[model samples]
Target: MGVVNVTPDSFSDGGEWFEPDAAVRHGLDVLAAGADLVDVGGESTRPGAERPSVEEELRRVVPVVRALAAEGAVVSVDTMRAEVARAAVEAGAAIVNDVSGGLADESMVPWVAHAGLAFVAMHWRGHSTSMQSRAVYDDVVADVCRELAERRDALLAAGIRQDLLVLDPGLGFAKTAEHNWALLAALPVLHGLGHPLLLGASRKTFLGRLGRHPGEPLRPPAERDVETTATSVLAAMAGLWCVRVHDVASTVRAIAVVEAAMEHAPEEGPA
Candidate 1:
């Protein structure tokens, strides 16, 4: 998956593709670069970012989704609102990548179920503006896994098909740098939940922090592509079903390398 943020305030690449034409072209570029799907998000969920009204988000995303789908691209609408998801699906989105995991909108699960689209349920504690305050966790990995399990069970009870769902342990939503690293390291634990995993660590602030030197400013979001690619490769090796990234080309190449490496590895004999 490749990210196309059609908002003016996303933490990374905001305003760069805010225009519909630019966003559509970027989506095409992502597909050309080997992404299986393009995730178009009109609202910026960066920490402390303000929410956009439904009308504005619809205006920004619907056209882009329509254009991309018209071009035969698999598109995912990255939204928290059921109304936006409904509109995007009608406009040509085949997937609903709800960062809130149906927590933000009560109608989201039912709507997704009725629409029969792929659903990405991200682990979210709260909306971006207040998420930071909710980041406290005794054991970040275990807590996240438990909470995400609860969400999965709830969605199942609400009529969402298990096979149509994907889980994302949201990297930066309300997590610290340590927490993000812990989650990445615990991919196997998350995978044990019996659902396909979607890892979205592309150009996030935690990657920037990892690249920072003492007494130096953190690397910018754009500069974290290298680390993001590394994460993509590792995620692929860990059997993640997909990785959401801003720079699709690099990640595609990285996953290719991982695949080739695994393909050539010696087979194990029975222990």
Candidate 2:
């Protein structure tokens, strides 16, 4: 996966692709660079970021979603609003990657079910503005699993097919740095829920804080590809179905190595 943020306030590459034309170009470039899917987000979920209104989100995403879908690339509209998601799918987006996991908007789940779209339901506590203050958890892994299970149940009740859903362990949302690492390390726990997992730790703050360099405070988002790939490999090892990443080529390369290793594992058959 490759990320294309059309919002000017995204944490990593905020203003880079804020314009529709630039976002489309970036999406095409990422696809050319080997991204199996392009996740186009109109709202920035960055910590402390201000949320954009539904109208603004729609204006930013619809064109890009339509264009990318027309170009034959798998397009996922990264949104939390049911109205926006409804318009996006009509415009051609094939998937909904909602960071709020149906908590932000009441109609999101019904829209997802009605459209029969692939859904990426993320673990979230609140909007970016107040999420940091709500990052309290006794056992991070258990909390995340419970929250995701609740969302999954809601989706099922809303008439969503089980196979159309994917669960994302919202890396930085309502998760302290340690909490993020705990979730990453305990990915098998989430997988045991029997749902396909989508890991979205690319260029996130936790990746930047990993084992600091000798003379560096911490690598910025632009410089965290190697660290991101390290976690990508770990995610692959955990048997994750897909990884949502900004650095597409490197993550793909890392998964390739992991996949090859798994394919060649020595084993006894029917012994």
The best candidate in terms of TM-score: 1
The lowest-lDDT stretch of 10 consecutive residues in candidate 2 is: 210-219
Clashing pairs counted in every model: 0, 0
Candidate of highest lDDT = 1
Q: TM-score, each model?
A: 0.98, 0.95
| Candidate 2: regions farther than 4 A off | 213-216, 268-271
- Per-residue lDDT value at 256 in model 1: 89
lDDT of 1 by residue, 1-271 (tens): 9999999987888589999999999999999999999999999999999999999999999999999999999999999999999999999999999999999999999988877778999999999989999999999998999999999999989888989999999999899989999998988888878999999999988888874687788888898999999999889989999999999999988898999999999999899
Whole-model lDDT values for every prediction: 0.93, 0.89
Per-candidate Cα RMSD to the true structure, in Å, reads 0.8, 1.8
